[model samples]
Target: QQYLERLKNKQVVRFASQAPAHPLWPEIERVTLEQLQYARLGVEGGVWQLFAEDGEMKMYKREEEVDGLAVDPLKAVHTVKGVTGREMTHYFFSPDVRFEWETTLEQMKVLETIADDTLVILQIHKRVWPASQRDALFWSHVRRVPNDTDRDAQDIWIACNHSTEHHEAPSNEGKMVRVALTVCLVCQTSIEPPADGGPVTRDHLTCKITYCSVVNPGGWVPTSALRAVYKREYPKFLKRFTQYVKDRCDKQPILF
Candidate 1:
């Protein structure tokens, strides 16, 4: 009887995401809010060094390592003329459109839908040569946070993804290397009333976006190569993702 009880407990932990009461849910909420705060803070001081730039987009990073592994923290901010934070959050959080914007993803699946605004997902990324392909399993949440600081500014929208476990999709299984990552995306929208006092159009909106991520490659990959890959990929990702959102939002009713 004791052995059977132990087996049941094991099974519960194995499928924790699907359990009646999910573990780490509180932590997920706390960390996600904290990430939004961090995103709003300005990146200054000597810790962050600017590495990439394009017009209104600027990228910063701090050089750091763990056991000789490159686990650099990245921050990027971009501004767009016509989209809202809600629209950006919508496309980013929706699993159906991920492949359209996330270029490196080879496969993606939603393991469980935790709620209307949250889910547990797994993704397999295309291999970066001379390294094993990678996979990530995590909980993703989307939220709207109040903007008390700027009374005139629209509410902020956020999408946060943090690593988590699953029974069927065990880590480091098969040929793929598992990656642990905490990624946060925050956006603030602003509106400019039409000069003609007419209906608000795309030209009357703008969005401010901040993206922060810390990715830990579970297995070893050359430090130089990892940094180079990040330097090249991060910029492209933000550009493509924002562009896609703008293109999609263009054809639809403005999400205010």
Candidate 2:
């Protein structure tokens, strides 16, 4: 309690503690790269069905099931004005500010710090009606990659979160049911340089963001109920979060 109060507004510096190599390291690396590629793929493939759209943001999903469970993969693309790729990824990856923007989160904790750019997190989300409370434990990693195709463009940023396990805080040990998810947030920045040849500013930047996630309900949940929740929640989450980041940038120095 004391720590939470003191830590409310401060971003936790990474590498607070070291964790040994994980058995899923190979999967993590593979998934991270795969997501980067998948995210950049255009929606013209005629597979993804568009379900939600607002301004520059569009959300799509493909109906799919795994072992009689609804595990629809979601892909959302959004263009945010006045922020760079680095700024978007920073807010998405930082744990300290999550509560401020993640309206559905009930609690979060860092279970392990794998490196300066990686950490294991435990999060409990507000329960949806007629369903058991849900929790997630995942390893999250953030990195910046050079824009190989567009050398003059600002670097791209990626934040990947994939479900993981922890002995101390095992899932399904309590009333909360665990949800497995793999989420990727990828950002690319475009600059609209000043016509006056002045210095660059946040106003001259726009970040094109791709968010992809596949969540698997650990227990048997009605497919309709799950899809209903996702349809109602995802768009709201993305819009509110991006607005929050824009507001934060307006209030302080932009990360990039």
TM-score of each: 0.90, 0.89
Alpha carbon lDDT of residue 251, candidate 1? 66
**lDDT tens digits by residue: candidate 2, 71-181:** 999999999998888888889989999998898899999998777678889999999889888999999988787789889988889999999889868875888999999
Among all windows of 10 consecutive residues in model 1, the one with the lowest summed lDDT is 13-22
**Total clashing pairs for each candidate:** 0, 0
Q: What stretches of model 2 exceed 4 Å from their correct place? A: 1-25
lDDT of 2: 0.88
Residue runs of model 1 more than 4 Å from their true location after superposition = 1-21
Q: After aligning candidate 2 to the native by TM-score, how far in Å is the CA of 125 from where it should be?
A: 1.1
Cα RMSD (angstroms) for every candidate in the order listed: 9.8, 8.0
Q: What TM-score does structure 2 among the candidates reach?
A: 0.89
Which candidate tops lDDT?
1
Q: Candidate 1, residues 211-255: lDDT per residue as tens digits? A: 999999988899999999999999999999999999998868998
